[model samples]
Target chain A: MRAPSKELTIDEVLGRIESGMTVGIGGWGSRRKPMALVRAILRSDLTDLHIVSYAGPDVGLLLAGGKASKVTYAFATLDSIPLEPLFSQARVERAAEFREWDEGMFQTGLRAAAQRVSFLPMRAGLGSAVLENDPDLHTVRSPYDDQEELVAVPALNLDVALVHMNRADELGNGQYLGPDPYFDDLFCMAAREAYVSTEQIIDTAGLTVDASLQSLLLNRTMVTGVVETPNGAHFTDCTPTYGRDEKFQKAYATAAKTPEDWAAFHERFLSGDEAAYQAAVTAFREEAQA
Target chain B: MSDVTRSEYCAVAIADCFADDGEIMGSPMGLLPTLGARLAKNTTNPALMLTDGEARILRGTPPLGQSGDVTEGWMPFRLVLESVVPYGKRHVMMGATQIDRHGNQNISAIGPWEQPTRQLLGVRGAPGNTVNNRTSYWVPKHSARVVVEQVDIVSGIGRARAEAAGPAATKFHDVHRLVTNLGVFDFGGPGHTMRFVSVHPGVTVDEVREASGCEIHADGDVPETRTPTDGELVLIRELLDPTKLREREVPSS
Candidate 1:
């Protein structure tokens, strides 16, 4: 596989971003999120972008930051992370479009896109207010002319996808050996360009033999770039290694209570280059160590 | 002693599962009882059951906490009486043997019933019920296979399609919601365009796309979902039916 381009700044990574591009992300319930990439996007002033993600903290930040225009999702991590602030505020106040789906139903929609079918048949409409409340989800005559009931889900053509993992090779073949293997590889394969962050770079061979689902779902070809951001998905467990620190999360939750607070927090946590991030974490680690 | 108080724990954590403006499926969390729980208000059935055992409540008082007695080997159903059954609205979130981005799911057999790549509970209320329940799903683990090209068997609906010659079409058509370990999502706003809405606390955009079996309408600067409130954590723990842990009944001193 070709080596990643030497320009390692988040700015460089994101300079290639364009409007109307579909983006995907990885993380679950404040675990293993790619903060560096997010911070970079926030500073760039990109707007009206469509986003895709599963459950986690990054979803709120994107909307609050005024970067995302439309969102597609499966689940947002954490138990009671109310979505009222993002959807209600972003749409009514900021004019962003926010919609929701049953967690699995969103996955089915992505599956239909992957298959390149006009519409996928499902038993979804039964007993669902989704059939009534949301005009987006509806029944259409089968384009295949096969008397099958089908749900027409528009194909998702993404511009980029970002993921965080336990380890990734030079070619972006990432591996996550965490207790909870939240969907990272699935999002990567579904996107056009994929970026990965990892705690360590290990031998590529171990990736194949590893029994974890994270490794099996991804291959070298799937990855676009890889960066060694140690303890990167940190504060969010990487099983058999370390985990998300409770103290930090509590601090973050409390600190990012408003937009201004979020911007300031992002500046401290995700603003600088890798070297700066390491210096800050190192300083914090040393303080705790002392 | 279990960290936060039970009610606070459930309330906060359940709220944490969604985007700030996203819709919910539970009873109390959906809307106030006086206001009729948010998700429950969507139910058309007059004889609908409330998450709290009440037929219909407006004030939305939480249900009483009462742990059940554990008998011999019945797998011990813990009395955390919280039920998504109230959010049993036209839309519901359920488990799956397999799931895709279109929101399709299967609790049916992966291989034969006995031996399989993954041994999941069979049928899981999807056979006849999927046609009636507005269903969504949760995949704690996201991968190519779990988020496969297509399910080995269609146990539940993902897209908007009518059953060919199977069960007759119901009032609702398909699953409208889908949440995973990564983010929250629904069908498209204008054209049912499937796109990524929000990411979880620590999740990155790339991880979601790779795990998803299909392409997503993802944006560059997606938002991060917020954390659940202390109250929500309690409700999710005590009320949303039992999951992950056993709700404790501490005897009054």
Candidate 2:
């Protein structure tokens, strides 16, 4: 009755995307990114995208592939590995437009969209170069207190938001089994449509275990499509369940340093289907164990 | 038996960044900051709210990257952001790609806005953190490129500039200290300008000037940064950072 099971294939989820649309990729730094969905996006011919993310590999891969025309993010890092080298190189070459904001300001913009507001006023950007760099941003003095000048961060409404969570029900109730949920729900809420990929799809009864997942759950109504992709957020961490594949991440970081290396790395890891990628991972793990 | 490395001295200087604070949440970004916060928590400021790199507000200073089966209680990211941060009771020591005389940090970019020549991380909570809590900086490699005349982009608001913004910005605007590989600095100088507090064991006043791109106000004899005590050395080596990752940051001969 309630649009019964919004489940779709990763391809179908990616098909919902079009070129020249603002897409928000969910996750924090290098953790819990919707990497499988990102892989599908990468495999497609969708080019000149405007991506908004708390960037990890999704931004780096997109930028590296030259699919993204612009990127709006607070920070772009691979966490332990630090700077996404490809993104750095791309920026140095003037490859893409960067609309950088303070993390709180960026999150506040998402919050503004989620609240269906045009803009939200905050003091985060006043003393910083955020307002100076962006000519479009305007400040409004508080009515009650004339001296308080707050920078108005415009709402960031995305065409689509892609997020990877620990688990979700068939009904699209997403849950994160990590310490930091990291504004995944806000990404869903700020987007016109949202697709979530999860490690597993449990029953509705399993959604709540002693109310542990209550705060961690993304409302099913906001989620348009759900795909069950186990070990979905690999390379980037899923946490508690599994830490980042540091070896693989190191390989990617190293390979991404040069164009020739990135191409080989992409062909070996990203060019293939998710199954092939998983197999390669298995092979790598076996070799490492050996 | 042997002398402590420059990296060890740098860690002690970083720890001194939090030595004065009574009881507050310390979120030290990067490896050096992490070591500094841990060292401070274990030694001087036991009241520091230390997280076990997971959920719990750790009572004991556990090893870095240790997770689960050890935490005292749940202190989710939500609680930290919403409650801890807003309370103005947090001290964050983060990296600065470029920092000016006024302590204005640039972790954002190097060139123009539309197309920066070299883009680093975005502002990334720097504005809010600097505005909301006591913020310090840790620069791994201090040179002219790092301590510049003017930062290309200001991610974190410095002392004088934050004051100029107004009382609203000035209330929580406290840029306490900046610990570098070469020396320690603070904004307590004239007009809240960054002043050279001390140099490391082997570093000299001339070395600090040679490294600084901007004019660093140093009136009196700049003392050598305090070396880590024997106990601190043991604690840092054994419980805090067993892997000796700090050595890799600013390696000692």
- Give me the candidate number with maximum lDDT: 2
Per-residue lDDT for A143-258 in model 1, tens only?
A: 56455554444445457877777776666666766544455665666677778876767666766566555344457677777766666654555555676565665545666657
* Per-model tally of clashing residue pairs: 193, 1
Off by over 4 Å in 1: A1-12, A79-95, A125-127, A132-134, A141-150, A206-214, A258-267, A281-290, B1-253
C-alpha displacement of B74 in model 2, angstroms? 4.3
Candidate 2 residue lDDT tens string, B1-253: 2589888888888888888887888888878888888899888888887776656777777665553344556666546555666578999888999998998999888887667888788788888888888999999999999999889889998877888887767878889898998999998777888898999888888988898898888868888887788999998888888988888888876
Cα deviation at A89, candidate 2, in Å, is 2.2
Cα lDDT tens digits, model 2, A226-268, are: 9988888998999766889899889999998887998888888
Residue B158 miss distance in model 2 (angstroms): 1.5
Tens-digit per-residue lDDT, B1-253, candidate 1: 2454322322222233222222333322222121122222222222332333222222333333322322211110011111232123434445555775455565533543222343232332353335654555554445667776556545566444333423345444455555555666665533343466666656677887777776666656878654554444444444532342223321111
- For model 2 the TM-score comes to 0.92
Best by DockQ: 2
Q: Which model scores highest in TM-score?
A: 2
